[model samples]
Target: MDAVQGTLDELGTPLSEVTFVVFDLETTGGSAAEHAITEIGAVKVRAGEIIGEFATLVDPGGPIPPFISVLTGITDAMVIAAPRIEAVLPAFLEFIKGTTLVAHNAGFDTGFVKAACAAHGYPPPVNPVVDTVDLARRVLTRDETPNCKLGTLAKLFRSGVEPCHRALQDARATVDVLHGLIERAGSFQVHTLEELKSFVRAPTPEQQRKRHLAESVPHSPGVYLFEDERGEVLYIGKSTNLRNRVRSYFTAGETRPRIREMIGIAERVRHIVCTTGLEAEVRELRLIGQAKPRYNRRSRFPEKVVWLKLTDEPFPRLSIVRDLKDDGAAYLGPFTSGRAADDARIALHEALPLRQCTQRLTERTRRAACVLAEMGRCGAPCEGRESPADYAVHVENARRAMLSDVGPVFTALEARMERLSVEQRYEEASVDRDRLAAYVRAAARMQHLSSLTTIPQMVAASPAFDGRWEIHVIRYGRLTAAGVMPRGAHPTPFVEALVATAETVRPGPGPIHAASAEETECILRWLESPGVRLVEVDGDWALPSGGAARHKARIEHAYRGLERRRAAEGRPLR
Candidate 1:
């Protein structure tokens, strides 16, 4: 009734206050597209009292089938003088205005109504609809009714009116069925129209009993935790409305097999209300990492993240490490896997002649050079073949390639690929091309992250539904805290409180912790989203000139062209 109000009011509207128009239809055939409505009947009721009624018989414009005439007792001759659907549909639509429509098999009845409206150049009613079939399924078990067909439900509920394949009588029967189901739903505390509509996926008896667990949760943005009987967290989630979201878990709306099982074991639903959706998201990440809930698959193992670290040495080398330290070494990732970190390492080495060896060397070290040194692929620092000054220059170039500038490295890789291609070594050229692409991707990511990490503080905001703004305060690429400001409220107080309460997180060499990587990526993703406004920045956040990102577009275009040519030539893509 009344479009079910908004989320807040709908949850509290009692069933007694809801107005319903129970309707039924007898059709010429099964499909609305191929047939027409023969009869229509509806009864509007409020608080158990009849307020209005509508009944009509329509001329089908064609002969009724022999079987239909026997079932409904309405033949062509009986409806010859009756008005057509064009006239009956308008009257029926008016009768059900400002009310929720109820029918035995609602889809069947509403489908014909919508079809008739479209055929006649009239807009159909947009009333909230309820199906008695769905309500019966939720309120009555199969053991009680065998099936939820309108006839079976009518007999089970002992309705005053019995269905007889006639419109008005069947409509009246559905009204009684609606009341009976409403009375049974009361046992589950489903007093509101929204509750009734959502009853199809009613929680199991245990979940229904634990509905009180969400009673104290405020109707605001927040994170919710579902815990099993042993008080161990089972699943963690976020919502714009804590009460509504947590309550939905107990309804049929939660259809995931795993979620259903989680709710079966869940004994409590706990929540942490936030001022804005942004805060809720950040908190969800933190809680998921802390609790490591069995149902959470992401950001749960922060300790397992890997990083690509540039070792601090006279002759620098790249290595994959699992831990981040306070040392002065440069780093590039909390890559999802060790293989990815290795790929990035190989790509960087292909572009710059940073040694591929693991040995730690000094200016006076005298270890024999490895095979890579023999090929002139390395500067041969291990054998002291290259002077310290010359090797220092290579190390500086590699450092710049990793942290800021990457044009020279890309240029070198491109030259190597061209030379290989001219020599008719297509496969070798392909390998070098892949290495260049991988290095470019990793370099672009590092440059972007470096720009954000260099900033001391920054504030970003995005408009949300209902005139609310989601505000986020980021420090060193990590979201330190977040807040929400209402339509007319001043954001100054909220911003101050959030910044004061914000956690102090130092940027990792490469987000070695999953929590650090997950949070930073989350903030970066949001900042890149369309319509996100940068509200304030305490320091300059700018990417370096001649960085990897500058060439990424051109490289992608060329990559696509190469792929198309290989496809046309029927070459193996691998």
Candidate 2:
């Protein structure tokens, strides 16, 4: 049953003549302009048969945010040695040169890729795109499906495919789902590039409703709800553009089958516009928890898996408990996995001299210490020689270290060793350095932690001096700040100040809006002066004290205050 050909109209040759490149991308965020892609997975299909596949991590020329790293398991280290997009994209383009792009959610992935390519001045892709999502919606009855999530559809069709967030696996899964749908439908049509483009009618009434809903949606910031015919929530999402976000579902091509089904059933849409993106995200998370939408997969449960805590008994036996039970015990495992908890317990026990036997401690009892105690590894609590109270104190200190500042301390210790290396102190510093590195490695293995900084209102916005025009700063999403700079402008003190300022930046006015070339040059020169000040430099970026100890302390206080203020007010950081 070659459904690829069978599903198409007679105007089209057998579907075997058609080719598709199933692709997926791991990115920093949902927005194409704001986020970046870290990895790409692709599989080629020709005539209903898999031909070749490719997957690669690409250096996005920026730090991979911790949230993204946690979600994708693609860390900065994994991409550090990978080729940059500029070096890899051309090769990728060649690989899929003549094939149609096929993605579960095609628009988002393709839109992002287009943006990335445009940023680097590459020609936009001319190949056609086939959305599995659109096909499911057009063929399946909305009420019967109720919801069309990739996972749900896979289950509905009894496809027996495992779901993962990975790019290639997902792309392949989408292909499988499409195959299953085509075989099941028995009656459907697949159009070629030219025919599809020709028949692509004006946005349907459903599409118009979505467009109007999107247009009416306040662009300020908010969460939107997509509901099916039965009034059951199909999906929950938040966006800075409420209307655009909702309309996205209607314009679907490469969306997941479940989402396509959801859109098919969607008889109504509603939205809540917020004051900011951060607020919208928080509200969305809360709403997802409250609604527990059938299509949503993320867990809302606060309790992650428990870890094992040791040092309860004389042997400090490992046990899995949510919290520490009593006074004379420092416990450890309440970790996600028992194996992980056990590994951590072993590391802790090795670091401290403790009885490794499964024996109890009693006052006045004497027995041969276990190997750990015999070898100076354990403070022989098994023989009742080491006071439980003293042992508990040690355990508490170790537990605190593991919980809080160990990683930073380890890093500092290594840096100190590196500094000492220049002074010929390697012999003395080597042991401590090795110990510190081991500790850091252990901490990393435990669970990589990342700090969430206040999302900056303005990031590095200017293109590196490209000899074309002056740079300008935009404020509150408006073009309030502007300055001119010559092509290849050197970084002077005022330029440094402008760059360091927390002000939002935007592109300069076009030549049509310019007064004169020389006038523009003059404005650029003025901006270049050390006396110029743009928006008020907020916080440490504006600080002029050269970062003395007091300045550092003040900055720390300000950051903590800001964090607390946001927490208390339930406000997103500005």
Candidate 3:
């Protein structure tokens, strides 16, 4: 058998030529420049196979933080007799030479390595890093149980992997997780060097200038754009497979004369990828709302819709459809076209005859009714035998089926026509069932069914302190909510005006204020603060304003506004 590349025992080479160094490090603290590396562990793999491994501990220059030591089980005493990080740094770099660095969350490990190298006056590693966190999120089931940690993945694969925070053990587990993820991602073979770089990033602006590059894009749901040489937008389109759709323009096949002409002028293509189909649809709608692309047909133009109209003529005739208006009288359409609304009226009139011209009704010229009159199907209006009041009753009945909710009630009445069917009433059941479906469609028109019971006061603003402000929510006169600090300076005029507004912003019953840009910056800084409290009703926290007095004033203004708004809203006077 060919040397199976995926199972390479010592070389760490897989079937493909891609080389990866799955690695982990135990450090005295997170900052590699200030702290030091306590342990280093790694396994080398190429293609889908493993090739080699290395693991060792080094003495950190400082005492280990108690929490970290407890978590990793690496103590200062253990590293006291070990060689310093400087001694092992060269070997660790050599072990990963020419290999792409891989870690669970690669940035966390890579950042430390870069810092440590910087400390030693060495250039940071140039090798690209792959974050398994991002990969697993993209490729695996998002709701996978037991969490996506190394231990969980090892358990899921039944790899018999030992549990430890030791660098070597974690590195081995990371490799196992990578293998499991690969097996699950069907047919997507990992590529090395140049191929990997392309798969990893969207085409740069410079590379996008080249011709014959359409075939290189990956097929995924996103918004695509066609741009001219001057960088002006020529057209925009959205698709579940952007690559396939864009490439289709370049392919030789049946093409619309217009598309063929437009393709010649297109110089560049660009896209924005969305994670889900629903997200893509929403994003497409939003972009269309913003840019208003000329070539896009469906959403570009707005139209006036028409509905079925009942005119108050002498005969009170149910005429053809008309345009919708805010008139008191009810109209039944807003349909795609006027003809469709008219067709519905024709169908309704045919199903039940409310017209006196029909043979079922009595006529003025004749003394007796027509055949329908004898069958008791009409009110005998044609023969002048039935009273106008009785004739009017029939018209009212037809109107109820078309206009009132009573249509559904009568539909249920005819549904039990099956009982009549056993008594040979097939015609009655069939007619009623079809009518019920139409009534159901009509009922769907009432979609805006909400009571609007509780009104939420939403406010976004910024404090003057350090160019930051916080968005606050006041519900029923209490500080029931808050958000990220806004970005920008709280202008003196706006602050003074707002302070006045806040004083009169009596508890409860008003529009919620949105945070200003400056306040938003402050909220972001507050969120970043250690031991910050996030709670129901409020996420309020003070931002370290980098010692700016203006920023301090901004924070104060936001707190006061929040206090006043919460009170006015009757939420709680905080």
TM-score per candidate: 0.54, 0.42, 0.39
For residues 1-574, could you state the per-residue lDDT of candidate 3 as single tens digits? 7775553343443425668899987776544445567888889997667899988878877776433454466666678898876677778888888888888657657777787777777788998777555455434442463235566667766665664768888888888887776665434554334433333333322333443646555688777777778876666766768887777666433123234434566777878886433335445554654565544444432233445554432223355454433433334443445555554554455445544342232233455545666665455555566566765665565555444433433333333533544454545544443343333333222110000101233233434336554444333222334333446544444434433444222332111122111122233344345544332222322212222233223223323322322232121100
- The candidate with the higher lDDT, 2 or 3, is 2
Model 1 residue runs over 4 Å out of place are 1-218, 243-261, 406-439, 464-470, 486-515, 550-574
Model 1 quality (TM-score): 0.54
- Against the reference, the lDDT scores of all candidates come to 0.75, 0.54, 0.51
Measured with C-alpha atoms, the lDDT of residue 150 in candidate 3 is 60
Off by over 4 Å in 3: 1-15, 47-49, 145-147, 189-574
lDDT of 2: 0.54
Q: lDDT tens string, model 2, 489-537? A: 5646445555556344332321111111222222333334553444332
Model 2 residue runs over 4 Å out of place are 1-14, 19-187, 191-219, 225-235, 264-275, 303-397, 405-574
State the RMSD for candidate 3. Answer: 24.1
lDDT of 3 at 356: 34
In order of listing, the candidates' clash counts read: 1, 28, 72
